[model samples]
Target: MTTYDFSNQTAIVTGGAQGIGGAITALLASQGARVAIWDMDAALAQETAERVGGGALAVQVDISDWDSVQAAIAKTVEVCGGVEILVNSAGIAGLNAPLADYPVDEFRKIVDINLNGTFLVNKAVVPVMTAKGYGRIVNIASVAGKEGNPNASAYSASKAAVIGLTKSLGKELAGQDISVNCVTPAAARTRIFDQMQQEHIDYMLSKIPRGRFLELDESAAMIAWLVSSENSFTTGATFDLSGGRATY
Candidate 1:
């Protein structure tokens, strides 16, 4: 396992209570970074923080709400000093249904959490990174953003927006040492799967030529490097973790 020194650095992993976010929190903490787990599930986030140890903290946040995001950043900075790294892994895969059949409220809800949430969190953290002139940020996007999936319009559109947002933010902060990037990963077996249909899951698998789902550790390995000082040169880039499913 390749290791990067994150000693004395503080990282914020939104949705860090479980799934891909949880894996990232564990990896960052293990490498000496004081990780802050931000999730909607306060209890699970606290459990994760305790398990990771090393000054890990759990901050409950509804990323969709600006006030909640504001509170989370304030609390995190108060406790962890300042955020040097951020991994926005909090997102959802809403119910799969044809565009015509998709409920209006459901679509709005999906966009609220996946798209607007990313915006609010990034907006809140950019100043902190800019103040210090150094930071690493990685927003979690989905392969569906690149290649639209049938019956998953809301998720695809929102993630596509995340990619665009990452690009714009990366360029905006290019003058500084901060690097902003995103990852478009294929499906992983996590709690988010509960919200998806079995057919949709199978369809996703069929599209991946690798015939396997992405692993949590694999994601952590890539993200660890992205958030490290070593990733200085790259910004406004999309790292693909789609298991051969991504053409570009």
Candidate 2:
């Protein structure tokens, strides 16, 4: 039996209260990392952090707001010592509708959280990682970004932006040992599903050739590797976890 050990590392997972983020948080904690969760939902975040154990904790944060994000990062650093791996998994699935029918405000909100949120968290952590000359970042993208979903225009575009940000940041930090990567997962049976109708769920499933929904464990497995010291020499690349749905 083998395991991925993240001992001696401090990790931070945004939206770590639930879904794939929750799984990642727990797994990392189990592997001996100090896991600190950042989420807008205070109670849920604390609950997940407690479940992770191993000196884990949760902080209420809105990643889109730099001020809020900055304070959250500060508190986590105080508790975890310093962040070694950062996973930008805080995101939202907006109302599914045609681009024409999408509300402008809603679109902006998605961008602010999905795209800008990633930026804020990275901005706050990169300098610390760079100084240490060792860091790993795994951002959560989407298969919809690869092959745009019909009614999820905002989501698709925001994820695409995340991929682009990963590429640019990876290059900027190429001189250092820090590597940046993103994962594009197909529609999974996450809490976001509750926001969608059955018709939409059926449509999403139809796109998955594997005929099954993505499990959070699967996503967490990939992310853990990306953040591990084992993931050397592979930066600025997007990992596709689309269950055979993504041709790219």
Candidate 3:
């Protein structure tokens, strides 16, 4: 466990109420950042924030909706000071089905939340961080994005777009002190599994050469440094957390 300094910083973690997002929020708060947990479930977000207990704030946010995102930013800034770090962990796995069999509405919904949502949140926060001339961002993507999954077309495509967005944004802000990057992680045993079919889950597990799923703390630790001041040279990059599954 490597300790990183986040003293006097403010972090916004979307989907921060549960699963990977919750882990990120807790770790950030523990390291001295005033964290804002943004989720669609207002009650769960508040509960998670309260549990973090360092003046952590919670705001109901629909990352896919422009208005909702704007409102969350306003609330976060007012309550948590300023947004210097943003971890876009808010996303969904759509459904497990072949492309032809995938539900049209579900596909759209997944893209809306997983891809458009990431874009919306980052778009809203970039300027705030740029004004300060310092910021750190970590967008949570997936290994499926790199190596598209058979029955998970929507999730793969959406995350692949996230990787592209991170690259473009990172380059756009290359001159600035702020850094933008994303992590492509293998499946982790999180509440997200509830949205997936057991067969699909098994398929994902089989792809991991490490013979196991990723741990929440491991994801949190990697992200902590990526969003820290210590990570000065890397931006517009993709960090692999696929447990020997990523070839590139």
Candidate 4:
């Protein structure tokens, strides 16, 4: 595997306890970065930190809540000194149903965690990056956001908004050394699939031209680069990981 120097850096991976987030947490720590796994699951986060075995820190956080996000960052800063990299991998995939039949509360909950949560985490981290004038941010968007998956309106819409938010923030911080970008990945077989129906999962699989689901390690590879100093020029951009599904 290709590697980058993250020895002196500290990274915060929201939803870092498992799934794609867990893959990233392991990879970053393996590269010598002091990583902080921020997740809503305190026990799992601590377990992930322990398993990674690089002095990784775990802090429970509800990314959708401002107060909780604020406290998470404060604790992270106090413990890790400062954050040089951020990967917003925390999100949810709401139930699969047509927009007309979707539950009102479920839709709202999806947006609250996926879209608004991204905004809050980015808002909390930008200033810290600005203070040091060096940072790399990678928000995990979905291919559903770009292509608009059927029966997954809430997830698609919220992720689409994440793409938009990344662009706007990237431009706002372009003058600094910090880079803000997002990735639009096709579905990976993670716990997020537990929330999806079998039919919905099949539908997503059929849409991928590669005829297979995305792998967590594949995503971690792309994201690891995005959050590395090597990704110095790209910001406000969307990197596609759809395995031939993305035309643009």
* C-alpha root-mean-square deviation, candidate 1: 0.5
TM-score of 2: 0.98
Model 2, 1-248: lDDT tens digits are: 12588898999899988999998998899999988889999999988877779888889999999999899888988877888999989999888999999999999999999999999999999988988899999999999888888888999899999999999999999889999999999888889988777877898899999999899999998998999999889999999999999987
Residue 44 lDDT, candidate 4, scale 0-100: 99
Model 1 stretches with alpha carbons more than 4 Å out = none
Per-residue C-alpha lDDT of model 3 across residues 1-248, encoded as one tens digit per residue: 88888888999999999988999999999989999999999999999999997889999999999999999999888887789999999999878999999999999999999999999999999989999999999999999999999989999999999999999999999899899999999999988999999999999999999999999999999999999999898999999999999988
lDDT over C-alpha atoms for residue 121 of model 2: 96
lDDT of 4 at 206: 93
Score each candidate by Cα lDDT.
0.96, 0.91, 0.94, 0.95
TM-scores for all candidates: the values are 0.99, 0.98, 0.99, 0.99
> Any residue pairs clashing in model 3, and if so which?
none
Ten residues in a row with the worst lDDT in model 4?
239-248
lDDT of 2: 0.91
* CA error at residue 198 for candidate 3, angstroms: 0.8
What tens-digit string does per-residue lDDT give for candidate 4 at 91-155? Answer: 99989999999999999999999999999999999999999999999999999999999999999
Model 1 score (lDDT): 0.96
Runs of candidate 4 with Cα error greater than 4 angstroms are: none
For 1-248, candidate 1 gives per-residue lDDT tens digits of 89999999999999999999999999999999999999999999999999999999999999999999999999999998999999999999998999999999999999999999999999999999999999999999999999999999999999999999999999999999999999999999999999998999999999999999999999989999999999989999999999999999
lDDT over C-alpha atoms for residue 21 of model 2: 93
- Candidate 4 accuracy as lDDT: 0.95
Reference-based lDDT, residue 222, model 3: 96
